[model samples]
Target: DAVYNILIDRWTKSSTPIHCIAHSLNPWYYSKEWINDVSGRVSPHKDMELSEERNKCLRRYFPDVKERRLVNQEFDRFSGGLDAFGSFDSLEDRWVLDPKAWWLVHGSSAPILQNLALKLLGQPCSSSCCERNWSTYSFIHSMRRNKISPKRAEDLVFLHTNLRLLSRNDADYKQRESKLWDIGGDAFDSFDNGAGVLEIASLSHDEPTMETMLFTDDED
Candidate 1:
């Protein structure tokens, strides 16, 4: 019901919290160990495949793992917010705030926002200010043919992701928001008994829905 509520009924919210939900993709959170940590029963749902997805998302996010991991890990260290969205929980576990949030947005974009909130925080913050400096730094560090020291590389990506998120000043943010609106309707009218159907389904796992991840954190 988590995915059902999210992709269906709850998607009607006024503000979508797609901030830095990158951490939700963290393989560790979906690992058998983490599942066991959060609940006693093992789930076939998020199993080992999460590691592959984590690596893929990270690769799209940064040029190098050592470089990417350094900055991402560091950013999270100073703040554990960004990793918030990618959780098995519909929302955080705070008393007052969590209850209210669960009552409202709940599983909606809660995790995504949590991730972005953490990534966005800094000594000083304003949506407009962070990205410019960050991009310049990334551009400089990622010069045509030079490898940045891991520390320096991290500093650069951290600044970029934090200060000037990839969509800073650009409408790419809105553009992306617009794109996701039609994810399900992109191709044909519906799935049918065709050979290609089998091939496509093989290409990806079952589409996630509320039922897909419905077990409580304790039930997992």
Candidate 2:
């Protein structure tokens, strides 16, 4: 009972209307096999909490009454297995494809809901990515480098983050025996190879910098 209480507390704190809406739109929750395997519960559409949270999300996402009504209509069609959503191919693909891809293929009938689904479903449910960015930022602006200007630190963090991302996709990174990519350690550790940091820093000037693209809107 203690464990159940803890779980419920955590869930109550973390769960939001967006999370509820995402779960409501997820195809797997509607699968008989999945539903039976888990709780043998009613359909997600029938879940009172999910239904209420979905309505909350609808109000927040569509302030215009007409747009909200259209979205609600589309939601009804989706939940009821009407029209395109009712087809065999759509249900079959639900089991085979990921949420975003499934929506892309079958979501044409409900463009507004599809757009919302794509945006919400594509999001990560955790703060780990943001934490990693802050970790990188901290490493760059540590006591030893406290003199670094905010703009310079920001640029460095951007470069470091993108470099790690790019390297993970590189053929050489994939073939490495260690396979533990970040084993090199933190704070631009991946570049500890024979390649000098200064050499890579020089390349940033040669191409379009992240500063131009990331902060352009702020400049306006």
lDDT of 1 at 103: 23
How does each model score on TM-score? Answer: 0.22, 0.69
Q: Candidate 1 local accuracy as lDDT?
A: 0.40
RMSD of each: 20.1, 11.0
What is the C-alpha lDDT profile of model 1 across 94-204, one tens digit per residue?
222422233244323344323433343312323323444454566667667367687777776676556433333455533454421222224323335532243234223
Count of backbone collisions within predicted model 2:
0
lDDT of each: 0.40, 0.76
Q: Which pairs clash in the backbone of model 2?
A: none
